[model samples]
Target: MTDGQITLTGIRAHANHGVLASERELGQTFSVDVSLDVDMDTVCDDLTHAVNYALVAQRVLDVLMGEPVNLIETLAGRIADAVLAISPRISSVQVTVHKPHAPVGVALDDVAVTCRKDAE
Candidate 1:
């Protein structure tokens, strides 16, 4: 596989994912960034030869909008796994999950976790 990369950033979804009960009751927005290491040889004029990014985004959104996890780290890993499962052409994936309104009770721009997964 050639060292080709594709990225989808700023994928936003609203969900109940946090350590607080209030968070689960009142969901917040989460932003995901995904980076994929793929086989450049598969890149061709035909859409079938390449990974469809729209589907990837939907998959990420599904994960983000599906379950409630306490940590952003878990959310990141789940997103990575989901993205990698999209196609064998994707060798590895990096996922970053951002939680803007964390319950840390402090002023912060954002809180996030990043995780990477490689094909087995």
Candidate 2:
């Protein structure tokens, strides 16, 4: 970030996704939030240079809907890999996977998993 620019946040996705016998059999949605740190100067100049939230969301949805995974952790990893593949300009990425209906035998709002990847 430079001048008056701060970290740009893309679109946040909320879906009930999970990995459990009951949850998967019944089907669930997973909510995902991605925070990316980018250079505003290049982004502000050209829209193409900026991170496209729609594309990012769609990429994540593709992974979630593509195959049936047994773990949200795996899903998070896949999301991170795909996002990095799509946009190389990204300096760092933070992905959070939220499972609202977990089978904990107790009332819980959601369980989340987060992963971060920085440029190498």
Candidate 3:
């Protein structure tokens, strides 16, 4: 494995994901950050040897918009799993799901869940 990483940050999506009924009904915006640890040795002039970030971003969006979950942790895990499935060159993935509009009833900047997965 090479010391190469692909990071995608600030991926925004609108989804209904919360424990509160009002939250589910109204929905909110979510931000996702993903990092993929991959081998960069094979990457040269061929695009096929490289991980397409566009595809990775799309994968995250697909999961974010696919279903509603009460916990961001679950959503993050799904994203990590999806990213790991992208390429065998990817050794591991880190996913962070941020809920900026969390109904905490207190002043807060954001609430987020981070998850990491290793290829088996």
Give me the candidate number with maximum lDDT: 3
Q: Tell me the TM-score of each prediction against the true structure.
A: 0.94, 0.78, 0.95
Give the per-residue lDDT of model 3 (tens digit) for 1-120. Answer: 356999999999899988899878899999999999988865376768888889999999999988898888899999999999999888999999999889888999999999999998
| Model 2 agreement with the true structure over 1-120: per-residue lDDT tens digits | 442222323334343345556665677666777776655554456768666767877887787676777777888888878887766566777888777766778998888888987756
Clash totals in order:
0, 8, 0
Give the poorly placed runs of model 1, Cα more than 4 Å off. Answer: none
For model 3 the local lDDT of residue 36 reads 93
Ranking by TM-score: 3, 1, 2
Clashes of 1: 0
Instruction: Name the weakest run of 10 consecutive residues (lDDT summed) in model 1.
Output: 40-49
**Model 2 alpha-carbon drift over 4 Å, by segment:** 1-19, 42-44
Off by over 4 Å in 3: none
The models' CA-based lDDT, in order, is 0.89, 0.68, 0.91
Distance from true position, residue 29, model 3, in Å? 0.3
RMSD of 3: 1.3
Could you arrange the candidates by lDDT from highest to lowest? 3, 1, 2
The TM-score that candidate 1 achieves is: 0.94
Residues 51-79, candidate 1: write the lDDT tens digits: 88899999999999988998889889888
